[model samples]
Target: MAENTRKGTNTTILINGQRGAAYIKVHKRRHIGYLGASRMMASSTSPVDDSTPSPSADASLGLTKPTTHLRIKHAPFKLMHPTYLEDDHTTAQGTQWHSRASRKHLYTVKLAKVHLDKPSTDAEKATTSEFKIRGELRLRTCHPHSLLKPRLAWDISFWVAVWFVCGSAAWIINGFLLFIPLLYESSSQGVQAAAWGFVGGTFFEVGAFLMFIESLNSGHEELYKKALRSILNEDGGTRKQERGKLRLFGLAPFRDIGFLGSTIQLCSASIFWISTLTGLPGVIPGFPGTSSVAITDVFYWTPQVIGGTGFTIASVLFSLECQKAWWKPNPSSLGWHVGFWNLLGSVGFTLCGAFGYGSVGNSWMNYQSILSTFWGSWAFMIGSLCQLWESIWREANT
Candidate 1:
């Protein structure tokens, strides 16, 4: 048996591996039980180091306190990451921590109390307070109605008047002239009648095309002014965001889709009208059924084909735009009807051109070519009138 010993608040037990039995005693109490040799340790106390700092030392440096929560009411700068600043006691400084998911929001930390060896001036404190103020600008969304103005309405009215008066009168004259060739007995009289019809058509088409150009320019100018106002007056203006540029045949740029489509259709029509001039004065002076000099070897039907194709493409694009406009909430009263009429006119023109092509191929389709052309031209003129009326209605109501 070993002699018993006592230590400070600790007791030791020894186990015999052969018997697998042990007895432990503490402060007048004893435990006798079987024990496992592997579970017993010879030295059980953990070593204490004298170099460890006490709780008082940690508290003195303000390290024991929990992190304070800060509510940033409004902030201007969008924080990207957690920003750290060295603790300075002279002036109030904040640290901003941003969440990865949200770029606009941030958590800012303002230390409650700081120690400073030197005193701060009034000017320095004022500057520090100014830095604490935060704000952000919320921009108003753009709408089509926002672009409309009184002056713009007046401009649209003036142009619409010009288009209707000239375009309508030209259509009336051409309608009467188209039937004259059938009534006339002389072939020369028919030629003269066709020449006069072209003259009237050219006069009105030019007027209508000019008005369309003016309206487009007016729209672009108004929108540009609106864009400028947005930048100078609104705080949320993003300088980098800009409108799309429109280009036609590598010339000056525009932005309005309606304007672009109309311009293309009119330019193609101008080309179509110009082609009619080639057939004029067929037997110039002395030459019989031939030109004095061979001006162009291209077939008589080539220009019509090319010009008609251009007109068809422009009409299709414009019709699509009209369909889109039709679906818009609270569109103009005449909007959908205008689109329908224009689409019908375009279809007629396409059919007319196709029939003309068939006639050139010496097909029996030539029998109906004049009738198709006459009706198609009339439909186009009617659609142009509807466009003018729609503009007038808008000007009066809007």
Candidate 2:
């Protein structure tokens, strides 16, 4: 079988069997609106009407039975999409856009089998004829995979990175404030650092939510298509597929790597809030959250360790979405770079958490913890910057 996916009026999938080639011509534009408060349009080109002239009317592809099983899988991709193209979801038509907001107009675009009708002539039946579609005939079929992807465009996704950059930059500022004569030499600085962290955590929460929403919006289409197909195919004309689309709050992300990553990141930020809020000098009356090293580690350091661990786990999940495979790295892709730097930042925080324990017992441990926070905060800043660049670079060239 031969396949051509080049940009033009007609794309072909060739299978030379008995006589010659079997052809399907695809071209149409499916437009959608309301992507992150913008009327940003996404256009897709699919086969509108079967334009390929049939070689002979004796044998032709027709939809006589439910043999057409619309299956969707990544054409040449090894990451993200490969996860959703499972057997249970093959007919499910589960597909999503590039999380970075590229491929604004691209969707699942699936194709089921096209059965050839029985040949009218015995001679033609013996010939093992290939295929042909009449010019006036119509076949509403999905492709093997999405062959055209538009370049990344400006969308709600760009701002998702911006918020992340803001959040990371705030953490960097707090890290800088930590470099004082002693851990809490100046209560004012300790309070200042806590304030920075709180601000940063707030920003992180916002970014994570927005990122989750972005991924959710993209994923909704898969369910939407599945629901529509259900009605047309009469699998169950009920609203079961329609009801599946309503995944509010944080319930839907578990099955989605991207959504799950964002949700975890959001939870990590919330955990940080516990430490940041309690660490303030006057946050609570008699309870000295950051006032004394003798007890500060109990309230602040423990949550720091827990939250840092959450970040590490979330980073791993995010990185997995971009890696070529679990053992291989994909540094060429912008999504990979975003995950790479975040992974580095998570590492720094993990080291900080390790050194942060029993700070009062050892001066070296105290100094190392502070040093790790300083470096880790800056690494986070770098990662956020990379994300910002990626959000813009997601421009589609298709």
Candidate 3:
């Protein structure tokens, strides 16, 4: 859309491609998710009183400019991951929704200023023209430039997968030990099972904590953005205020599905610690005692229920983050697969928590709960393995 500003003329680009041309993955318009060109309405908090004016349309779309041929904006879009924005003078002067996906699959969406390619026909001295730009969409590693890089073994994803795998494996064994009555009847085996559960729960808490921390700087793109700005020094606004507030704790009530999911998951893991740790034979005085069902319920069962519920919510949010439609699976999306299994595990854990409550002496309830735990742990392990595999081979087939 064309509009006049107090200082100069500025064009408000909408995502629908009504005013300009937009391309996904540099040419592939048929994306699997809601990855779209990003546009931001002018905000009162803009660092400067004046917004960056849209460049005047020349006889050509600045193809003659020294900066190189094309004047179009390139935005990388990842259909499999949550959307984020990276604003730099290299593209434009405003924020836009973008994707910075895998190394090989660095799918970038380009929004070109086709209108500015020609001089206005009825001009009294017109600086801007009007035209609809069009381009084919296709995925290619040789082109579609992006700043995103491949994952490393020491990255947050790797650690998260490692911890989850260990934790899930431990829980699987613990569940099995309790599920079999003969094994559980032996006091030594029961004690050992509790010990294993404690270890598993500890590992879960650590992994969940890491995930929440990772979300603080989701995708770790901010660091790269800052690094690039140090060299380019574009826009002249290097102050912290102009860059935006520190998102160390994930600001706002409810933004970013991954952030909310990780936060909830972390809290759940922490709360569940109460049951796993205290239930150890010597951790607490009244814990692991057959004498009082009420005490066991208070310390163990209650926390499990609360944690399980939280985990379920988190898992759902995570799954939702990976989907365009909540009911349908994203074809060929590894992130979606990871979410699917985690959601299944969350459901199992929820059932386990529900059945494990009330009477500690109910054999039926115990068996059902243990069975749920065993299945849930297996599901969790599978998801963890998938994540690990994805993290390790991010650029393999991208």
The number of the candidate with the highest TM-score is 2
RMSD of 1: 31.0
**Global lDDT of model 3:** 0.52
| lDDT tens digits by residue: candidate 1, 1-398 | 22223355433333222211122222222221112211222233222122344442223221222222222221111221111112232223432211110111111111121111122433223222211211110111111232322232444334644554555455445544544454463243435544654564465456546545543432222211211222221322112223322222232223334455556766766766654555355623322133333332232334455555666666544444433222342134233344445455445544544565555435355435545545655665666665555444321122
On a 0 to 100 scale, what is the lDDT of residue 86 in model 3?
29
**Decreasing TM-score order of the candidates:** 2, 3, 1
**Which runs in model 2 stand beyond 4 Å of their true positions?**
1-154, 180-188, 220-250, 284-298, 396-398
Between candidates 1 and 2, which one is better according to TM-score? 2
Residue 159 CA error for candidate 2 (Å)? 1.9
Q: By lDDT, highest first, what's the ranking?
A: 3, 2, 1
lDDT of 1: 0.36
Alpha-carbon shift of residue 71 in model 1 (angstroms):
33
